[model samples]
Target: MRGRTVVEFHGEIDIATTRQSDQHLDAATARSAPSVLVDLRGVTFIDSAGLGPVCRAWRRAVDRGGDLTLLCTDTRMLTILRLTGVTPAIAVTGS
Candidate 1:
């Protein structure tokens, strides 16, 4: 069976919710080389504090030889990722 997991996040993502977000990402990516999809379509806002978990999840998936895709259509969020150079390290799909 192909192991794939999807994590959906909503509302604003910041320091107040990083830990919770990280927990969700960690659980989904913990499986062996899982194909993880992070659905950020519901996220209305994100800051550097929020980006930390995304980066960490990406690194974890890469280190485990897995694949991770980010789903989002927020121009602001995309801009932030681009400005931070995180766009190069992760795969993002407009949703």
Candidate 2:
């Protein structure tokens, strides 16, 4: 049953850890879950590579009439996104 996949990632996630994050996201995509909740409460860092996959996931959700909701409990990640000015582009919650 393809349903929602809630992926919670922690620790530093930058270009160095992109592949690792990608692997997780790819697994979620492969499942094609109806809804995906990416919780970034424990994330210590995130580069474009890390952000790209989420955007891609959002697109995939839209394409499939599904939804991708982002829940972030880390302020550091929010700052990075604000500075990058891509938070609005991607659905994010809890700055």
Candidate 3:
């Protein structure tokens, strides 16, 4: 994990926190890491708005020739991401 950076997301995620999350996600992904991990293990609830920042951060990492992976274990959140077709866009793994 020396060349990787992990950005942890905590608690519930909704439209109210998108801006803050996006800002932090952007900053984390913008760092000089070969891979970026958006850790969602601590997140309880997530909606479409929550997915936006994660997707955007993934795109930013990809545009910089880096990989952005998601670290998530919650079954429901994983199901939501899968049903929304976001799982295929970025690598999703467990801690």
Candidate 4:
């Protein structure tokens, strides 16, 4: 919404899913000044592999003068992001 490309991720996000997630994220952040929103509310589990794509996407967005936001209401996910030092680099919102 709001002229942004919204990517929603569900279920477990681990090594197995990173490649696909990376592809989508890469596409979402390809254009200059692209605005992307990654919805992670449906995610139940995530690991370092999953976070790698997120961080890369954030970097790509910023490098292209764009921005990427994460939508996650799950406490566990939020905690993981925080502990992993990912929250500081990306904007996260919920509901």
Ranking by lDDT: 4, 1, 3, 2
Per-residue accuracy of model 4 over 1-95 as CA lDDT, tens digit each: 23899999999999999999999999999998989999998899999998999999999999999999999998889999999999877989986
Candidate with top TM-score is 4
**On residues 55-80, what C-alpha lDDT tens digit does candidate 2 reach at each position?**
77777776766777788866777888
Which scores better on TM-score, 2 or 4? 4
Of the two candidates 1 and 4, the one with more favorable lDDT, higher being better, is: 4
TM-score of each: 0.93, 0.78, 0.91, 0.95
Worst 10 residues of 3 by lDDT: 26-35
Flag clash pairs in model 1.
none
- Is 3 or 4 the stronger prediction by lDDT? 4
C-alpha lDDT (0 to 100) for residue 48 of candidate 1: 89
Cα-based lDDT at residue 49, candidate 3: 92
Question: In candidate 2, residue 95 scores what lDDT?
Answer: 38
What value does the lDDT take at residue 3 in candidate 3?
66
- Residue-level lDDT of model 1, residues 3-95, one tens digit each, is 678999999999999999999999988877878999998999888899899889988988898989999898988898889888868999985
Clashing pairs in 3: none
